[model samples]
Target chain A: MNHHAAQSRAAYLFLTPFLALFVVFLIYPLVQSLWLAFQQTHGPSITRYVGLDNFKSIAVDRLFWKAFWNTAVFALASVCIQLPIALGLAMLLNRPDVRGRAFFRLIFFSPALVGLVFVAVLFGLIFEKRTGLLNVTLHAVAGFDPEFPWLQQYVMPALIIAALWLYAGFNMVFFLAALQNVSRDLLEAATVDGAGPLRRFLHVTLPAIRPVGSFLVLLSLIGSFQLFELPYILLGGGGPDNQGLTVVMYLYQAGFDAGDLGYASAIGWTIAILLGGFAVAQRYVSALDER
Target chain B: MTPTLSITPRRTLAKLSAACLTYAMLAASAAIVLTPFAYLLASSLKTGEDFFGSLFLPAGEGVFGVAWGRITSANYTRLISEFDFTNNIVNSVFLASTTSILATLGAAMGGYALAMIRFPGRRFVTNLVLFALIIPAALMLAPSYQLLYFLGLLDTYTGLILPAAAPAFGVFLFRQAFLSSLPPQLLEAGRIDGCGELRLFVSIGLPLVRPMIGAFVLITYLGTWNNFIWPQIVLQSPEKLPLSVAIAQLRGVYSQDYGLLMAGTVISIAPVLVLFLLLQREFIAGLTAGAVKG
Candidate 1:
């Protein structure tokens, strides 16, 4: 055999274990999920082939719609509000004038060390209406009464706040790492050309980190959709009035809680499609932003 | 720039205030980040009564007096004794450690094939890995559950560990690292010296790729350690559930005691937190491998 052919054989031999596992666990499951989406499942087995019924049902399903809306809102907040704050703080830390950069970086990155489950549980206590730390502090410091409905009337805001606290640090670290690579000479050139700090930031620094910036946007978008466990644990059965009920929560309900595996598979496919579109749009926008 | 920096009173004042503002912002952000954890510690230490009656757990019976008094480990003891948290912690450690080690090793092998060893269909295989990475785990939940069920792996560590044991992210990162960094001359030298493929991979390639292994292990361990929903679905027996699922059950009206709940939360995250603190740089690099140069 030629060297290239022999090498290919050796490569295949080396790849056997990974390929086997990946095929059995990841690829096969994904294909099976797609197939499952097309059939009506009673418990675990398929009862009938549902051509377009599952997709059609989701279009009219109010709870499903609500979950989608909630997921969208949370995602927007993550992309728009939380990520910007993280980026701005990262910029501040990246500034040479700042003292104790390592110290500040460690402090900012601390929250991310704790897992999401812990954050959810901690926030359950923190956002509690009565005898909660937030309310007590507000009442003491600002003389505001602790009557705000967090878990009930304002579940989205509450969930968003908790999530922001948990994940803002992770994104901040990402931005910080990106910013560390940004060529200082570019910023200096912008400055020498008479751009002020904000102007230099807008023109030079922003463009320099655009790749990481858009990457963060994409990360936030995908992370926002995978929202579960936190809200599920915090709110307990989708919170009051199902306001905190997220897309994954709805998927979980469909498959396990309600035992409608077919509908659950449909929801999963819908999310994959939605995420693909957002990712494409985000890529386009970022490409345009680069110019 | 220096000509513009004439130290006028206004310019000096502006610069000073900007510095102050920057420090103020950093401090505020740190406070916001730290409060949850501080409360976690405080709540974990408080007696169940104190936890219920007080907002800040260590407050010495009055708001202003807020000095530490009567902090206890009773909650931790109770969590271990009552809910079998020890078993779950062991389960979590096992699941996270096994998956991380296996995933890293598997990715190393696959990445070596794709990057070091020349192969046909390599492009197609790499594309498949990217596709796998893009498909979120939530979307795979139902089918994965059914697959595990059919394989008779449900309620077993194999179910939890096997799915994530050959993760696509690991494969991608290891491939990129090896392809970009590994010297082909070294591989050729090893081959010329009559090292067989397996021996060459172990003696030469694996050692040179320590950082990639570190990255993969950190990322995979962090992910699997914090896994909740997937493990919850598969793990039916309460004793077999990882701390993620066990701690989650401690939420809501089921939360008979805040101290116990917080204690469970503490135990759930303690190992990962310690790991993160020690491997902070590696953790960040592992997470941001594709995005950043480091």
Candidate 2:
């Protein structure tokens, strides 16, 4: 009885800091945000219970819908472009016969290590209309006009490119590590049985790395939804005509700019639900595949 | 030994084609990845005239000769003196280091307890941590900002470091590392030697999980250093801002000074690059280890 009592005390002691911090920072904020979602605040202190009105406002708001669509487009485009390229790079770097693999891996992964703000700044320069390097290069190489605004016509694509550059290498490292864990004997046996490289990859490699792929896909999806800095910096926080405004950026603007804390809270809850639903769906899909 | 193996022409062609394709793809990918960085470097080196005139090409006048002329450390000097870049660097370094150490220590204790000691509510605690991980950070923004305001920690380093130090990801990563990498006999031996739980963690558990600790330190430090939005909201004073926020301020104030902007960026990115280069192997190992466990 003493031992059990001592153990429980120790457990609580061990958990105190994390639980305290979580309550103060995470859980309190979480509950408060939900509360704020329902209660309308005129200023910082003026609060009134408005029930579902804030959520209703969010549902009908055109800017909210635009931001939602923008976010969805950004997320989908980023995942579709990044995953296959990262997988292919991982496969190439995973090959035993490849020389200078470490150097290639390092170069590839270098961009990801750089802060997102730096990446945003770099791409911002590159995508500049008149004096930017990208425009200059296009003019020199293909005689393309330098006056064209890359961000205006190609906002999503430009963001997707930046996303791919920053993330593909990082994701490649994960895939490479997962690929390394595939049993060498199985691959060797497949090769010995006259299976081609592509055949071996399809039949053996794909199965072994499927879990990693699923995890990356899910992570990328979540990351895509939370996308903020790159678009914020590159396009000047929602760019021309709010074309670049992602959901998180919109949420930030609403909370900070519009001071619509209640409405922003609704958006936050909506994002959480969407992300959670997708993650659960992905897990289900993975389980079904296993079965 | 008697039979000479001969490759078929079709097989040879297929192999050659595959090799060529791989090379082409890698080259293209590398080009795309490196172009923006290359542009930044080139632009930084070009004269103002060359910057506007031949922006795509390398300047005939070197970085020193262009604009400020003769390799002036002017931009960097200005970055430090005018922007208080030095202070921002110190603030970032201090915040990152403190967060890393506090977070690692907290996680180490939590992870060791969860992994080695059997206690009631273990499953519940683990599930809660996982739930924390899945919850979007944006959800916590408004409330956390308000809480920080209430505590009178707004614009202070404590505001930046404390909220970040309590990240669920660190605990999750450490727990996963402990489960897989830590051996049971060591803990038993420590207990047998009459070592207390805390001592066992400090002496035995810590050394065993050095790699994970290293990994957590890097991830935590980098994440804190690069954080933009939270700091943007919390930090009101320009001097208190980290490099990420400072760089954004540069954008707002000196939007036209591409050279200076790129210089600031290059300066901002240098430490991370150096750290990455030094710890490339450990970084990869840490990432792979985390992914596998997740």
Candidate 3:
């Protein structure tokens, strides 16, 4: 066979399975879903091209907006809490002198192994209004009544705590690996040049892991958008007054509960747009900081 | 020099404080991560009265006394007799194993092609895989469900296994590993020996990508085992449900039976913990592979 022909044949042969599946499952569905976003649907089947009617409905839908806002808040709160705590833990664990680091690392990373729904259930028990561990401990310590409804009144904070518990260790493992990849020579050189631990970390270590940091930020941002199973299981599918409703949960509800598949598709597309926009904006800001 | 060499109490105290602070933070963080599991274990062993009474304290009481007052094996036994937890476990393990195997095979071939072959559309395929990484699986849920329902495969293992086996992340990871680690001349040498392309891939490529395969298998297995939403939507029958879904059902039905529910939750999470402990090195490598790069 000629070289070009051989190459083509090999490429086609090797790519057959992935290509077929991608077209059938990914590409086709992707296009179909986008189309479904515009078409109005009474049930599972789309009726007609409504030309932004679904989008208009989503724009004015109170529940949809509540979920969107709740998700945004959750994402911001999680990133803020998870990143700093992860960074600190990663730094401490990276220290060569730290004893029992391996054991601590395993303990820290254990929660991520638990399924999201399981964590939600576990936290639900922990945050139970009267008999929860939190209230019980508080009552014993301060002689106060154990009546606070954590999952209901403080839904956002409770959700954040659960998110942090489920994810912080996973993030820490990432940061720890990145820290290991940082050159020890650079750190020692900075220390010898009279830079203290804080200064050296801020100026030298952070700059070295900038790529990893950026990547983590982007991944966390995407993860924040895709928040579903936890909120769905906990707080009874978005809690009291929809305080815990996330965008994806809302989309699921729209499609499954309300039978508005077209509107749900539109909501899904809107999430994609929002995530893309946020990623771009984050990249822009990071680039500006670098410059 | 002599004065610097001498240990001072003040400096010792400062160093001690630093160590204490580090240990304190680490201990507190560890407690927060582990306390929930501890509570779960404790609650599972206690009866309702003891569970309620010792909510915050350690369950110093025996497992048989207050926590497990109804000491009948009904919950555990019922999981087999009535709830089909055993069948769900089998279904989950079977689906995860099949997905892992299929995903690894496809990833090996595609990764080998990308790494060794000078093919057209290589970059295009790579970019497509990366794009798949960003497209949240949630977005695909509705269409995927409808497509499966249309295909009459909604409740079948084939439906669950096949769709997941084609994940682009596995392909991307294996391709990156092959490109970075595998030398190009090995393939050329195999070609010179008159080996056919498929044989070369099977004999040489598969061995070379074993670690990546292991990593992919663990990742894929974890994803499948912990999968909830897709199976929830697709499987209508409880018998077909995976452990994750089954556990959710148990929670829904036995909301008040904290001990039984906690036992079920513990069982659900045990496999994951075991897998993580066993393949932790590879799991960390896989996680780092996804996180440290695009």
Candidate 4:
């Protein structure tokens, strides 16, 4: 009994530092945010109890809907466009015939190391009207418009393109790992049976990598939904016509810029609920796949 | 089934073409990916006048139609002399290293307890960690800021580092690492040999999960180094601000100065890229371990 008591004591002592900070920082904030979501506040101090008004306002708010639309479109583009290129790159790298695979992967993955804010700074110049790298290269190559307004008129596309460059290779790392794990025996058997490359991929490789694919999809979606710093820095605050506004940017504007923490809390909860739906759906899909 | 017969001229030609195509595609993608980085480096070197005068380097009668003399270190020098980026760099290094070390230690200890010890509340704490994982960070932003305000820690590094040091994600990672890599029998033997609990953890448990410690430390350091919003919210004093916030402020003020902005970014990004290159294996392994295995 004494020995057991000593072990328990040691365990509690080990856990104390983490548990103490987690409770104060994580748990308290979580509960407080729940309460704050239903109230109205100026800054963090001045408060008024306006139950559900924030949520209701969000329901009908045009800017919030626009932000929602922009975020959804980004997420859709990420899944559809970016993930395919990532998978393609992974497939190419997974080939036994490919040499210098590591070198190629390092080159592709290097950009992901650059933080989103810095990416914004670099791409901000890259997307400039005349002297920007994109326009200059395009103009030289194909006589493309030198004065194209990427950040202004084509906000979502520009965001998607920037993100594609940043994340496609990062996601490719996951797909490559999955590809390398696909059963070689099954692949060889299909090949011997005269299964062409596309058929072999569709029949043998795709099913094996399905789990990792779903995981990457969810990861990309969650990340896309949380987009802020890229557009916030690149477009310099929602671009020309609030076209680059994201949910988190809107939340930051509400809380810090506008000094309405209450409405910000509401926006945060809305995002939480939406992301929760994604998680649950992901679980459901995985469960179905298991069955 | 017959390797010799499979080596026909048409088959060889087809395979060669396929290989060529693969190389061609990969090379194209690699060039596209590297263009911005090359542009960034080139842009940082150019003078303001030369920046607009040419795309990459100022075109002239020097080697390969490029004016070698036009490339200047003035932007970099100005950053150090005019703008105190050195201070921001120091702040970034301090915050990142301090937060990573503290967070790693706390996580390893917490993981050791939850994974190896048969305490009464282990299940409760484990459940709490899981619940905490799904809670969107955005939800807590307003409340965490308010909490800091009430505690009078708003502008302090403690306000920033303390909260981050206890990330549920780190604890969960270490727990998984300990559960898989650490054996209960070893700990029991250490206990039987009269080794103190803390000593056992320090010497035995930590060694067993050294890779996790390294990986977790790197992840936390990279995260803290790159993090903007939290520190931007917490710290008000200019001297206390880290690189991420500092760079953003620089952009705000010198948005038009392309050379200066590029130089600042190059400085901000180079260290992490070099670190990632050195620790690429451990970093990639740690990044994908949870996703792949779980």
Candidate 5:
């Protein structure tokens, strides 16, 4: 074979493993998920077509709505609460006068490496009623309630606190990088123009980091929507009154726990659509902001 | 940027106070962030009684008013002996390492082809990879489970490892890394030197993207190591379960055994954290590289 033919042959050979696996695992499963959403199945077998019944049931599904609301709350908290603190920390670290930047950065970023499952395991105990670290510390510091039912009464807040610890620093790293790349000249120009610290930050820093900020928001949203392992393990499957039910956890329960793969696929489809909507909305907002 | 305004005494005092406030916040935040890990470590050493007795370390008639004598290794011992966590640990090691290595090689190869090679349908494959990026893993859980069952790969490592080996995210990252770093001329040079295709890839293509390899391997390894849901669904046999599932199950069975649970948590977290500490630069760069660049 000539060089062109030979190179093409070699390229296909190189692509074989990834292509094969991608087809079998990703493409096939994705298409099958779309198909499976319309039909109910017992385990992996005994499927029956139910048209739009799965989606219809999920439409009025109070449990699914609760899961969606909980997930939305978490995502909102991530963007509003977590990302602001992250950006604030990033601003702190990005200061030219700051010392031990790397040390603080490492400390802040460490929990993110703990992974979601392990974070749940650790926080599972940390959110305990009286002896839990949170309650004890709060009780000592501010006369807070020692017997506050975190996993029971304040399930969403408990999940939010755990997620904040897990993700704030991770998001901070991104913000820090974006902050570092902010045009120093423009900031100095704003300072020279007698803009206050807040004003300068508003005009220069905020606009500059908007892209990364939005990206982090979308990422946080997608991640929040798929909140399964953390809540599943932390609350031990949708805590009291199913207050901690997440979309993916609900999907898992429907699929594995309840052995209804079809309903699970429908939930999966709903999550996909919601996430895709977030992506598009984010893109549109970012595009508008650029103008 | 020089100070356009003169530094009055009031300004100096303000700056100093601001610095002090910044330090205070950073210190407090760091403490809050690290308190749980400390709590985990201390809890793992305390018995069930001591767990309720003290917040962190048990307080007693020891140095610093701490009950050092009450610290115990029984939790770790129980994890291995009574709970058979050692088998889970081994299974985790096997699955994580194998999956990571295979994934890195597969992604590097596929990415190299997409980035460097001139062939038919390259655009289609590249677009396919890009399209795959937005398809969330959660979307595939149910169907993939059924597919695995149909293939009779459930309860086996192959079911878990094979799907993860060719992650679209890894391939896209590797593709970006190669496009930015790997030189077309270098590959041409290797070709002119009469190197075989495989040799050119293994020797020349691989070394050019070493940092990507490091980052991708660490990412994949850490991902597989910490992954819970997929394995929980796929693996039915207890012995085949990795540490993630094993730890969850451990908690399920012995939720009240705070020490044992914390001990298991420590085992699950320590290795990956240490690996991250060692290779944090590459890992962080790899992680944020995608968001910042893409």
Candidate 6:
């Protein structure tokens, strides 16, 4: 008992430095943000007990809803399009006969190395109406003159394209790792049973990698919800029409831009609740798939 | 049942067509993937006058018309001389390295304790980390700023480094690694040898967690290097801002100068790009290791 007590003390000692920092930074902020959501603040220094006024105001805020919806679209694209492309590429590259596997894998994943901000910055010009490569290519190949403001006009799709370019490779890397773990014997057995490649993939391979797939879905959902830099830069911080304002952007604008720290806290709480809902939905869906 | 000799004309033709289709798909996807990077490189070299002169063709004639343009390094020179590239790069490097080192160190110890030691409320601590994982960081944004301000840490590297040191992912990773790789007998043996707790940890625990430490370091470094929003929110001073924020601000500074902007992006991301390439395999493995385990 004494040994156990001493050991536990030592363990607690080991945990102190990290937990000290974690509680202050991670834990305290969470609790404080929840509390701050219910209050009102003029700036960093000004505070008043508002008693749910911030939340009340947020419920009627049009920009909040717009940011929510825009973020939801990004999340949807990540799951529906980005993940599938990644899975397809992984499946393709996982084939036994594919040549130059290393080269292709590296090429695909190179984009992920570039920061999201850099992607937003680089693609801002790459999609420029006049000097942009996208338009230039379209003009040469199809004899179609490009005139639309790719960033300002079609904000969501353009952002989605950039996201796909950057993240498909990232997801592909993960899926590829997951695919390699699928037992070849099981696949061969299914093949001998006259299961075509598609059916085998659907039944055997997919079932085997479902955990990682669900994990990736969750990961991408979280990633998309954290969408700030891409939209912030690409659309020049919420765009002319405010079509690109993400939830985090709204929080940022509220906190820094408007100096409404309390309202920003409220926005932060809403985002937390929404993300929690996503986690629950992801869990429920994964459970259903498991059954 | 002679399957080996079953390669009839139709079968051969089918296989060939399938291979061709596979190659075509790969090629198309590769093109889409490579286009932006190709454009980034080619345009980085172009003169302002001929920035949009030709799509694939560089500004002047010969060698894709980009030969002389590549020689100038005008954008790069301007980025360093005018845009505070060197300072920003140094700041980013310092911040990222500090955050990465601190986060990894804390995670390793915390992971070691969680994985090895019998302790009170270990489960609670573990659950707290799991909760941290689920909680959206956006929830903490306003409070973090306020907290940092009260602590007088805003706009400082300590502000960035301290908060990031306790990432749930790193904790989980180190714990998992320790659980898998650490042998309890070493601790038992060391304790019998009368080594103190701190010494035991320093001598045995440190070596056992090397793989995870390396992986966590890479991950945290990458994350810190790429981080934008929190730094954007916290660090307002140009000199203190990391590359992520500095480059983001570069857009306002050099609005129409695409070459300068691209140069900044390339320079800011260059170290991370090299590190990512070198450690890409381990990085991918570290990422998937958790999911694959799940």
Q: What is each predicted model's overall lDDT from 0 to 1?
A: 0.81, 0.79, 0.77, 0.89, 0.88, 0.82
Residue-wise lDDT of candidate 2 within A1-291, one digit each (tens)?
665566567767776777778778887888898898887765345668999997888878898789889988887876788888898898887766566778888889889988888888888888888777777778888999988778987788888877888999999988988898899989988877888879989999999988788878777878888899998987778988888888999989988787667767888988777556546744643352233
Q: Between 5 and 6, whose TM-score is larger?
A: 5
User: What are the per-residue Cα lDDT tens digits for candidate 6 across B139-177?
Assistant: 788999999999999888788888998877677677777
The DockQ ranking, best first, is 4, 6, 5, 1, 2, 3
- Fnat value of model 4: 0.66
* Candidate 5 lDDT by residue in tens digits, A144-207: 9999999988999999999999999999999998888899989989888889989998899989
**Candidate 2 chain B, poorest ten consecutive residues by summed lDDT:** B64-73
Candidate 3 vs candidate 4: the TM-score winner is: 4
Error of 2 at B198 (Å): 1.4
Question: TM-score for each prediction?
Answer: 0.93, 0.92, 0.91, 0.96, 0.95, 0.94
Best by TM-score: 4
Root-mean-square deviation per candidate: 3.0, 3.4, 3.5, 2.3, 2.6, 2.7
Task: Kindly report which residue pairs in candidate 4 clash with one another.
Answer: none
Please give, for residues B1-294, the per-residue lDDT of candidate 1 as tens digits: 364457889888988999999999889888878887888888888885667666655566555677455678998888878777789889888888888888888888898888888677988897787666667767888888888978999888888888787777777777777776789998899878877778878888888778778867888888888878888898898878888887887675566477778888888777887887788776677677667662
Docking class of 3: acceptable
Q: lDDT by residue for model 2 over B18-109, one digit each (tens)? A: 77777777777788777777777666655455566655444345664443343345677777787778888898888889988888777777
Kindly report the fnat of each predicted structure, to 2 decimals: 0.68, 0.51, 0.45, 0.66, 0.68, 0.66
Name the runs in model 5 displaced over 4 angstroms.
A278-291, B1-13
Instruction: State the lDDT of candidate 4 residue by residue for A1-291, as single tens digits.
Output: 887888899999999999999999999998999999999999889989999999999999999888888889999999999999999999999988999998998998888888888999999999999889999999999999999889869999899999999999999998988898899989888888888889998999999999789888888877887798999888878888899999888999999999889999999999878667546644634442233
Give me the runs in candidate 2 sitting further than 4 Å from their true place.
Answer: A1-8, A139-145, A276-291, B1-28, B56-58, B61-71
Clashes per prediction? 0, 3, 3, 0, 0, 0
Note the DockQ of each predicted structure.
0.55, 0.50, 0.47, 0.58, 0.57, 0.57
Q: lDDT (0-100) at residue B126 of candidate 5? A: 85
Predicted candidate 6 versus true structure: per-residue lDDT over A61-81, tens digit per residue: 999999999999989989999
